[model samples]
Target: MMSGLRRGPLASRFSPSRQAAMKQSVKLIVGNWKMNGLSAALAQAESIREAVGAAGQGHRVVLCPPATLIDRMRTALAGSGVAVGGQDCHEKPVGAFTGSVSAEMLADAGATVVILGHSERRAAFGETDAGVAAKVEAAIAAGLEPIVCVGETLEQREAGDAIAVVSAQVEASLPTGLSERDFAVAYEPVWAIGTGLTPTLEQIAEVHAAIRAAMVKRLGESARTAPILYGGSVKPENAADILATPEVGGALVGGASLKAEDFMPIVKAAA
Candidate 1:
């Protein structure tokens, strides 16, 4: 454990072995349940927890279930290797925003991490780069690590501007005042998500390298080592190769993450 770091309610709940694993600076695999999951799905969480615990590997694992499952999953995964998180959060801590959940609420619900600036949110809700930066600030303030996503569209790739588009998004969406300790970045191409399609290994390496260079320039030197994850149609067959690529720190698993049976192989690949 880092000296002078207080074990808050969230940290206090973690088992010693799990806490030790959290201290390591290495690859991380996070599951974004994305508006899916229910009370019964806790069983899946249990299975995932057991699988990770038994493997006894060093890679960090997180499950970002829907907002409703955050509290329960946190409690259920207590003293286990799996950490819990929220899929998204509003910039404000509190408000009358009827259906929106804030960074503070996610923390209060026991989330240690929160995903921000995903392409889906940007496209569906028209979330601006400025808004994502604010949400990043809010997430850090609430003691939740933020995984800010930056990606390009199919059209941009076809136009031969994939590198430029993602570079700009990384510069704009990721805020200043961050370090290796608190946040991560995901390169999830908007075109490939759930399309059963993915960028080539060479293509994935190119973007991740571009992202790393952009992060080093945008967020400073610490970002050179900051986790840069790959998302979009991540599955067992391609996971080993994807995780093996240069600058490909880890993955943000989508559909495969909903079930331990599917997600663990990816974990094995990372391990």
Candidate 2:
């Protein structure tokens, strides 16, 4: 005989049918801690772990702290089933470059992924696509997946050249042999990032589909399984709709990721 008790709403949410759909694959939710954090910020990771708990089993969670905190974040997430990454890395394996951390060093520090060509890196530091390409290749050489970011500015979008601009950046930033494995790409419009402006669902679909098409052209079958994440002002309220759009596999959350309360809902939305 079976017990007559019923399952709780939260427990019943991930039904066997739903679990099958989720499986080993999941929507990725990555937090770009970006130049922020000290040893104290490890608490944020703990809070995030608590908030996620077992409920986030259906989604992949990544936390990217500044280089200074990557090792610490890695340790904190050791048994939490979350992954830690770096905000940036150098193009060379090792060199005399001051204030630059090499991809090899990041890999040594337990960073499985690194973000390259972020808008801030481009606008503030003047990073060119060629330079981004070098960094991507270095990261790949060191066995770190590079989350290559590509998008256009508000002016470019207004001029209707957003697709052209991002396409060119993709071609220049991505290295050869992209079809070898499923890497990550994030599309974050410069003007939308942290600016509280989000592109419409139709707009997001158009850009993401275009990006996927470009990937297929460049990488063949491997492009089909690649995870393309959307960034720039992603919020819980809009996460579901945006993620449901074609080619949008997950998100690279910015301001919203700073708080567990704000970020968990987005994870649920993706799940």
Candidate 3:
């Protein structure tokens, strides 16, 4: 945490209207816990709570821990401005999917947002664009905003298909129904996740601009206001520069988010 970072006031009320109007803000730092965390990890959360206790109106903070920790973290961060979220959820609200958790259950457990179409899910679990679209619909149906993600692999970038790949994914992964809802998109270049590498500022701007153009085509003129966040390798060291880019409204942070000391500076940078 950046010792100079200041916490915001207690969590603010979230209404559907307010949700729709969130496009007016800038920073929206979200932490994806992936499959890590035990109950003890709540301490880091508490530290984060203290650090950003009265964060500015332009900044928003969210933490997406594994399923088991969602409810617990929500309760812990009750008054803190930090919001709790889920990493993934099945498209259906109710089913015999066994271990699969649906967006409804996540919402019930206090997840205000759900991340779908992550590169890990797409590559490791074979989550196709169609499937991601379904989950986005599910998230809305369950009353949870979805942080839909899209990105390109190193090979695709090397092959000169980075923009095309991301454009196609945005076209396929986002459905027309999203035009009626509030959501955010993340561009997490696959090669950068935990790899300690990041695209140049120009490279980041290019992809973000491409994504904005794609959404504009999908949602019409209003899409220009959508928050296209940069993910992968987002840490305190470079968060300021990355967030300063033209279309980088915020970030979808990975490993650096595990601790408040590291995450706060990034959060502060956004502020």
Candidate 4:
């Protein structure tokens, strides 16, 4: 572990093996295609799968296309070691909510993972922390691993409240069910998504460390081994440096993940 990036003071109390496990969790490279991809995109998924053969053993690579492509992508990438996921899911298993995809629906469609509480969902749809927590519960219940997202806006960072804002989201957006289920926390700064702007490595490290501390406070040791992913303008050019950061266990990639040529390098960087 890096000098001061150990999980927390409580980490010392755990067995050495447990301490090692915290830092040794598999690196997760997730491609968030977000409202992008059509049938033709299946070829890109196949290319990614072909290139990823045996390369992601110590890590995991997941591709989350739009709801329209979940099952098709899952079928195309079946047994390729690349998991398919959904960009979002509704909090309920079944309801009258028209046009909303439920966690159960995602699971039934062959999606093994789901992204919830993304900054776009929060900003464009006004999703709240409590709402995200509910969706997390739904995801767990539906047997899908949840990638719960939390981040601050550019204005919040400029006001010197980035850490506090993210900490609160960590406290409220994740549910107790995650203590036993496989889940991940993604920190995607609102301003960076699709803007080609990214936080400096030092800034990314600081926020990631703060996120690890927050998770420890909320879930104790169970949270230590959970992956904390950094999202926002992540690309092959900077993937290695960002993934090498102390508390950053993986990346939730956006635009750069839309194509095999661009996404493969980022996956290899994680590997």
TM-score to true structure, per model: 0.90, 0.89, 0.91, 0.92
As for lDDT, the candidate ahead, 1 or 3, is: 3
Compose the digit string of candidate 3's lDDT tens values, residues 1-271: 1111221231124443353345535578899989889999999988888888755556889999999999999998887778899999999889889899999899999888888999999999999999999999999889888899999999999999999999999989998988845678899999999899999999999999999889979876546556789998999999999998988889999999999989989999988
On lDDT, the candidate that comes out on top is: 4
CA deviation > 4 Å runs, candidate 3: 1-24
Q: Higher lDDT: candidate 1 or 2? A: 1
Best-first order by lDDT: 4, 3, 1, 2
Ranking by TM-score: 4, 3, 1, 2
How do the residues 1-271 of candidate 2 rate in per-residue lDDT, one tens digit apiece?
0111122354257764443234224677889988778898898889888777756455778888889888888888887767788888988888799999999999888788888999999999999999998998888888887788999999999999999998888878887755554467899988899889999988998998788777767666445556789999999888889888877878999878877888888888877
In candidate 1, what residue range of length 10 has the lowest lDDT sum? 1-10
Model 1 lDDT tens row, 1-271: 1121233566557774454344323568989999888899999999999999876564788999999999999999998867888889998899889999999899999999999998899999999888999999889888888899989999999999999999998888887867545578999999999999999999999999999889889866556546789999999999999988888878999999999999999988888
Question: Per-residue lDDT of 91-187 in model 4, one digit per residue for the tens?
Answer: 8899899999999999999998899999998999999999999999999999888898999999999999999999999999988777745788999
- Candidate 4, residue 66: Cα displacement in angstroms equals 0.8
Q: List pairs with backbone clashes in candidate 2.
A: none
Candidate 3 lDDT for residue 17: 35
lDDT values of the candidates?
Answer: 0.85, 0.80, 0.86, 0.86
Winner of 1 and 4 under lDDT? 4
Model 2, runs deviating above 4 Å: 1-25
